[model samples]
Target: MAVHTLSRRQIFGYGTAGAAALMLGTGAWSTDSAFAAPVLTGNPFSLGVASGDPLPDGVVLWTRLAPDPFAEDGKGGMPATPVRVQYEVAEDERFRHVVRRGSVIATPELAHSVHPEIHGLRPDRVYFYRFRAAGHLSPTGRTRTTPAAGSDPRELTFAFASCQAWQDGYYTAYEHMAAEDLDLVVHLGDYLYEYGVKTNKRGVTTDPKFHTETVGLARYRLQYGLYKAEAPLQQAHANFPWIMTFDDHEVENNWADEISENNESPETFMLRRAAGFQALYEHAPLRRTQLPKGPDVQMYRRLSYGRLADFTMLDTRQYRDDQPCGDGASANCAERLDPDRTLLGARQRDWVLKGFSRSPARWQILGNQAPMGQTDQDPGADTLVWLDPWDGYVAERNRLLAEAGTRGVRNLVVVTGDRHQNYAWDLKRDYADPGSPTVGSEFVGTSVTSGGDGADMTPQGEQFLAANPHMRFFNSQRGYVRVRVDRDRWTSDFRVLPYVTRPGAPVSTRASVVVEDGVPGVQV
Candidate 1:
């Protein structure tokens, strides 16, 4: 794994050396002991930068120029190089009248990733932005701010997606997302999977290394670099602002608070978790509000789109009870619905209810990582199989929905991901009773990749669709959903790509689910 040679013009010799030295100083260990001497050459934007968590008055921007991504041997240090990266925001395509301009230093200790939260802009307005490094201008990106508080927006269009596996396929879903008319994109976790394995090694147990994530700071930085390399993902980030939350795959599969279920001690897991959170903060274009407080990072936040919709993004992993393994025999089985079981902790639950009760927006959307529907394990099993989703926290889900009804919150929609399949269902008070009242509606998007080796749904897909009457559309395809929200109605077109293996593949509408503003559920 010799370092890629750099051309004279492309090279940043002294600058790279300085940054590498800074990195080495920050950490006790070398970045790359495995590769004798790490030659830094990859472009900073090889993994692109993105803006997210848009505010009416501003937007957060992010970028990392990893000249030597794997330099730290996983300790997350390199020589400190004071590399000045310039950024510009404009109202138009022309270079004239650039609204915003600034240069930020890319320190080697943070893997040269810059997280800049830009403010002082008009609300509900679109702006173009780009970055310059070492006399090189990266691709131009378009982003917008949310409407001012209390403003009456007639319509709000946003997209939610999750589960992007780098090796599975090309990010065609993001390409389609860029073409759509969206105000913002909500990413419900798995922004990047820790898994890295050769395609040939993928079998029943894919990624033989079992999700080789970048544990320390340097590895985390490289992981972000790998994801930014995907063109479609980069395009989507450049196209519109995003609201993001991480699912378990971002760190490790099914990792809960302190305990990892891997027999690791709480101290060991927390240290790793800290590194994961730090890397996430470093790479994402998130507001300082999202920054961690102490060892715990709170990702629960709210965003409103004028009077049209209010989006509540949650953290399902943090503050969650360990996934109930229920003994070794039923290790995969999430424990049966317990009244005391909770998904969102007591405080967050209160916050959600309070937000819903006070929301002036017509539509209240919950951007979440997992499904809200009751997924029965044995097809027609009367007993609901308690999975890691809302199903596991029955009492909590019921309370939330009941509160919505009690407070007269109309058109509650939950956008979800993580099952790696497309599903649309009418959220009900109870799945056991087919005639239960509809509490809300849900649109679950399939994975960008990572369910299987291009394998579509089979028995479980068929049975779940049949058993669950409210479930209208189900597909195991690899794609995303396009959502259009308005005062009168909200429409979701489930778009599926032919395959993710190739680039430039055309996408088709698999199904459409629409819900009138006054209606709590969908009309299919």
Candidate 2:
């Protein structure tokens, strides 16, 4: 492929009416004045542009025609009719070297959102893209395709973050994340909170429109609009390609497979779940394969960065068995020992294990929602553990850890979210045995803004570290984790922000740890 240059100011005469006229194959606009479409008035790209699910030769570009994102009808301020939107991909930020150009239809049925999958591009290269519609040019977004399959890549730099509650505090962490020199961003889960906000600890006023918990499609769409409308969050999405998954809060709190936290009827809860899944699909830069089918969406998928890393993203909430021992922190009981209990359903477990057995990448990274390490809340004679995490599904955890050892995976790293604090642990084959083999390492990232202005440490944090011998480091703060992976070593920096209740919080490294290629533990 040869590089070509065009004027940055070059504007094509392509418009929605022109495209519609051409589609009719009769030049309808040129012949009939009465059939002319009305002119659009405002900027429709209020929610900004994003790209995700990047392959070696392709990437998905996303944008919504939301002139008014907070519209009560959840139509994104788009008319009832479908509209044509044009997009372009270029090798230069100035868009002077255009590589690919195409158009997609945005319909009201999907809230005028469009996800255009662009392909036929060179591998392991950075590209710039933008959307054009209604004579308005959207903010240019930068995306990069992964290296060719089975090709050896020297390095992979990425960040993983989660749990950004819009009303909790300012999105200062995302502001810093947007400035990082990273290839991709992996959002483990909790992209949006479903709970209503009346008042926050910061004394910030809540939007009345989102003052109620999101229940159906319209409310979920409104919540997404409210979050995506944030400048810092929008900047983060525009700066880099993101790989995202969902947790319970995206639909409701602590919702497992077919059971609701509030014990709502299955039929009623399924309707809410379906709406939440649909809204998530419509707002994010996901591919067609992830489209919602009723209450379920295919989320667990694999992404390869050449021979350097393989990211196996998991969906823990969708297929998980209900929390054993009646949920929350509790003492070990017989029900918790059920071998049939599962976190990842049988199919997903088989898929992940198979990937582990056959993966050729140097680093086998599990992008998961919950922490895999056993977190003992109380360490005395009466030990108490949180059942929502791996502690709840011990049998499955042991099986997966044993499988990793049996398969002889070179470097198994589990990057997780959902926990509001940062944790670095040495994953053991058996949590009950201190002498068990350390099969892998886990990095649990802190929240973006979920837990207001967190401190360096808390009493619970001290108890947690004192109780779990496998846990190496712990920090109660608001931020994300920056990771750099290479053939020889993997380094993670626990990036933290001082205060999220106020704006302009400076981000700093709270802790740094590195694991060598053959090492299964972290060196602080």
Candidate 3:
């Protein structure tokens, strides 16, 4: 295919030559092959720069050149050929103290996205990086390495967010998150919604592509292009490194493993899933190891921040059993009581158990997609719940919690996102018994923009809080959760916004909760 790239300025020129050799930065491979710099027009870095998966020694830097982000063809208005992208990391914002500089090719196969996983740097320090391509210099992004293994770090401040449906409202939450002092951002799924919208919340006409739901590679790519082009989202990604995973809407609503929510043909559904996975990997700042093999990608992993905390990110959707009784607020579902039903397939469940036993970290943080606590949806004696979450797989939840409690895992905390409502639940050894021991704590965050300017409290929210005494706090609002952790305690602030349908909404902390060391439940 002949490659072509369009720029806003419509100016076209050949790019300058880059490094003579290519280094993967992951310390994986090196080649003396001549770098080929293609002709790129205008500014290709329209999507901006981002970094993620920060390790003790290195991090992944990402950038894609798309002058025309919403091009119907889904090429980001770039030539079909690969473009050589050069990057420089400096000790300071200015290039005067440059540290690491290298080149990587942005290939059309991945929609001209570059994920350079560079290594060989000092641990637990700050660095600024930028990208160069087609005579254009991308924006500078700040990222830092985690503390060296076994080293005691003083504190870590980060934010966790999810469910940003572009058409529902503006990304005002992201703009606020970008300005906050944070070390990292953990995105627990629903990065993009698969549904179509006629217009976004910004009161602008959406491109024609937004009228149709995404079903293939091209449509998914187009969807990402539209969201990534937003300046607020881009700024958030640029401000701090992110650890990402996907939930239902990234593929389809409440989709189980190899099963579509609408029950589309198995073959057809898998193909669409493949496209979603491929597009997600192409746009995300993930390591090469997590590349999709057909419809499967190993997204769950463990990240350690010294001996203070160990984060075990879970993939709740891909490996989950289908929801019991068709996935709504079911009054009584015996199918969910099956002992063999699982949310995290056998391998993943075992991984989590083994990691818990072996990790030396004082805090066990489960970075999860959905609420792990049993939510009694009905205040009456007849229990009801939305069955897509852990509530659908009671056996797995019980077994997992049993192990944590039995083994005496200290400070077991689960930070969750998906329900669009903020909640603090005391994870009980058995939800059936109100007086059961509290094995862990679950903090479920509200959505970034979903539910469209939610209220401070809904009637249903009030009802649920009253019914479930184990649930300490509940709020229905639009915002993310900010967390600060130290050796002594864990604090979570439920940040809120009054409106997202309109722009320039101010943010405030609606509620703040803490769990002291050696505690397994929420405190005032």
Candidate 4:
């Protein structure tokens, strides 16, 4: 069994309260060799730090310290070491006049991951922070708390992205996002893949040729450790406080609460599923409330951006009925159209509906795991895929949209991940009718590195778009969205980075979609 043990020398060197290092006895594992380990080797900042769910007066700071990363057991071969981590806030780039300072201890039970909800600061303020353990110092990170409640800020800029498979390509998208100078980032899902790959060389796209899977906690932790080893992804997490949600890939490709009825054993899969969920909580920087409830817990919740927007993040995978294998285009396959079956579940759906009904913000946005807008498969048949997202839950979708329409919630926008493509659509009553009326809006973002399949607009995708007017635009591209929200309008510039298979590739603007307040849909 792998063991986590701390030497007395390291304990003395690190001190009690996370101060600088003291002279220590030297051994095979030293700070110098640890930090200098190859990219794949375990490092202090191996998993990186991230902040998320930013509130007006506070934001959540997250970091996981792994002394011996590759250990099969979570122990990382180090005895339980507790290190105090101090955070600093500053208004200027130089941090000349520090605003807030405090410390939190990184404990081993939680894999040494720290989530300090730094509160009691100016709202909408920019700050800088870093961590120090022993004589070693972590990379300087940039983050800010939201403005105080009831303060009307002039403009808000943020980015949303998802679906990064480490073996697929480098995290070039993260490199661009870190330099975007945005206030926050919204991640729809698939933060890390529970799989591994074998490659010939470094600096190139690798493949898991065989679908290596994650079973126990050790496998999951190592998978996360591998992805965090990327410098660009680490920098992006260090750069901003993120708002994250989980989709299917966090566990498996399209796993629901139970197994797919015909695919696997529900009892066995649920136990594995629970392990995956716990591992995610152990590694990521999410709040206590976001923790898993049992073998499963819903992750759909709401976050607001002052009076500018209200974001409702949803979990579509955990609450839906089994998708049809070959139910075909018959009404049976359209089981999603049944009012009995649900997507958001009762409680989550109610929470979102009530939120939309009461929201006073100009824009009601949804941070969804799958596509909510209608798409075309054939004619007169606006059938949703039983295995895919909204397609698997049609009746529930209609009810949600119907509620929005009836409540007169103007400018309803949904930001989505999964499908590994970018899409802009006009949510309407019907897409197959050809005379459907626009109800709300949706801006679906493409994946970060999942086989940029649709990066180039496909003829089939284009033809589908033409047939379905509700879908204003679509692209199979690898990129993220830079959104700017003001009092009157919101502009999303689809920023595309060059192919990640190649290094230092130049980024270019693929397109831009803009939506105005009170406008139910978007235009070029």
Off by over 4 Å in 3: 1-29
Residue 189 in candidate 1 has what lDDT? 88
Worst 10 residues of 4 by lDDT: 20-29
Best candidate per lDDT, number?
Answer: 2
* Residue-by-residue lDDT tens digits, candidate 2, 75-187: 77778776667799999999899999977766666777888888899999999999988778899999999999989999999999999998788898999999999999999
Where is model 2 poorest over a 10-residue stretch in terms of lDDT?
Answer: 1-10
* Candidate number that wins on lDDT, 3 or 4: 3
Error of 2 at 152 (Å): 0.8
Off by over 4 Å in 1: 1-42, 70-78, 200-213, 325-335, 384-386, 452-457
State every prediction's TM-score relative to the real structure.
0.86, 0.92, 0.94, 0.85
Angstrom error of the Cα, residue 280, model 1: value is 1.6
Could you give me the TM-score of model 1 versus the true structure? Answer: 0.86
Q: Compute the lDDT for candidate 2.
A: 0.86
Query: What is the clash count for each candidate, in the order shown?
Result: 20, 0, 3, 17
* Candidate 4 ranges beyond 4 A from true positions: 1-43, 74-77, 92-96, 199-211, 260-262, 325-332, 379-386, 452-454
Q: Is candidate 1 or candidate 4 better by lDDT?
A: 1
Screening candidate 3 with a backbone cut-off below 3 angstroms (N, C-alpha, C), the clashing residue pairs are: 3-79, 3-80, 4-79
Question: What's the lDDT of the predicted structure labeled candidate 4?
Answer: 0.70
